[model samples]
Target: MRNTAKITTAVLAAGALTLGLTACGSDNDNAGADAPLTVAATPTPQGEILTYVKDNLATKAGLELEVREFTDYVTPDTAVQQGEVDANYFQHQPYLDDFNKENGTDIVAVPDATVHLEPLGVYSHGVKKLTDLKKGATIALPNDTTNEARALKLLETNGVIKLKSGVGYEATPKDIASNPKNLQFKELEAAQLPRSLGDVDAAVINGNYALEADLSPAEDALVAESPKDNPYGNFLAVKKGDEDDPRVRKLAELLTSPEVKKFIQDKYDGAVVAAF
Candidate 1:
């Protein structure tokens, strides 16, 4: 009887060991597979869009989506370049090109990953229209090269300002050929433009920041970038050699999915537009 009891205990211990080993093997197999794909983005549309994906789509698709919000342009790209984050979704190609060139970072735009365009719009509190502004009325613009140029182009397109013939994406206030309103440009960081509206006659605010401040570009903008052939759509980006990372591919697919398209259309109300 004693021998039989000992034999039974030994068998039970062996079974437990086998079960534990199987469980550990399964966990090991899924360790990296289940790891989160962290992406950096700006708060309004980019962060909101990613949050939608994470809440509605990621679990069903088996994606562990994580989003980090950034207020400035420089950090997201640098984080990806340093492998601090898996991907980023805040910048257009032109801005990325300038960033890579200036910072000597190898971050690359995800292949075929045009996500959304946040049309740079001129917004104001003092005037209902761009034409209503008094001469020499101060207008604030983003100080960054890419957005400053874009803001100038928007002004030029609306006939508020004119550029030197053939002054392209790199245009600046110095490139303005005519300022019929004699509009004075106060150059501030993009994030600060919304707050500057009360102090300045008008401010050109990027779509994301504009949205964050509860200003709808579609309704509030005095003038906005025409979507046709606009090249400043924001996109997902990864480090150069990390392009083929499966997590990135999954996110890229999800970002351009029909569901995301509908979400953008419904949520932003034309303040944002689908680029893919």
Candidate 2:
């Protein structure tokens, strides 16, 4: 009962954004109350979570939902911005903020619609512990802005490295003030980090990608971000003015409902934590 279709970067780059505009038309047409609200999401937890809503909760709540899956992070926002999809559910605020500022896109979160938290994790095949990594060992990180800063923060938290004072979420390797082991870093796209584990000594991976790769954040991660007061809760987001669309509102309500909470807890265990 999963209503999902996968779109690759090639297709997106080949005028898929324009195609979305042609198909969905303007924001008003896309948000028509009777129409299905298409959402762009990454395949792991976001698409799966939305699929669960489509098959179960959405109908009961009088919503028609369609899910389109994308592997890369950038396309989903662009898809939403271009009206390729009505909304997206794959990113946290830091990422969204950076994307909007960088691309001049006006995507905004659906209010109070924070759904889940996929704790960022550090994983390795060669090392049993952070201290086990040898001098000059290379660790791969997500190359995008927010995630890279997040990865750096994770490393700093575990004492693997130290950043310059007050670098905050924008911290990068260039901010690293200390590296006791002189650990080298390989910056790759977030999707590629799990695959890079075999090549690098270790990698800090996003929770969703870790789940997609079948690495349990609860059991497999050497270290992970604590969810307490975490600002990275994944949520539903739409281009600027779609917040009040009836369909978006209904989906937002359903996304943060008790049913979705139970589904996340039961299906993902500690790998995905319900944020509502």
Candidate 3:
């Protein structure tokens, strides 16, 4: 009887050891590996911003910050949506709103500085100023809603176009109630606006694209959008569930810091205003 009791106790102990080993294996499977904080951004301004953080801030924050660069607008948001990236720094509120509506995405804005406001400036190849352009001068601008409205507003500001009464913010080309210049507007790609400068009498150019085309916003713009009122101000973009993430907060902190402010001033000059 004594031998049988001991045998039963040993079997029970062996069973407990097997259960414990299985639990440990399950935990190892769940916690597979540590991944670094991955941030994706466009190649122009936002890329520059993230590069600063990745080069400077990541070491102190105890993070391996990997920044991926995307060329066009569609893929960055798509990458974030598909969980290919942890975060992305790109696009303003209006652009984001349009993207979310069209794609059925729930990506959220993480707190970050408005890195740069790409001023929608109307520039002329032949004429020096707004008054110098002839009546019925052909004007070129981006066809997109955000940029088109911005161009129209600037035109209205310079007494070129009179929009509908009470159409303060939401004014569109269709809202143009009067065209005193009879300026024919040619809707082109934002990237193509700089090229259209020599073709048309004038064109409204985005800052980054203008830079790519070797046009200086500081020197060339006959009239540029104010950094204060410009709608194309960009921000840090993150996945829907990660707004409250610690890494995102840290990255945002680094972006809005005094160091970055100086970097913007030193590097971009007046072209990219630090919109913190």
For model 3, the stretches where C-alpha displacement exceeds 4 angstroms are 1-34, 168-171, 229-231
**Residue pairs that clash (backbone atoms under 3 angstroms), model 3:** none
**lDDT scores in order:** 0.82, 0.87, 0.70
Residue pairs in collision within model 2: none
> Model 3: per-residue lDDT, tens digit, 133-186?
898889897776666777888888888789888874445677889987777888
Counted clashes in each candidate structure: 0, 0, 0
Ranking by TM-score: 2, 1, 3
Among all candidates shown, the one with the greatest lDDT: 2
Off by over 4 Å in 2: 1-26
lDDT of 1 at 134: 99
TM-score of each: 0.87, 0.92, 0.80
TM-score top scorer: 2
Better of 1 and 3 by lDDT: 1
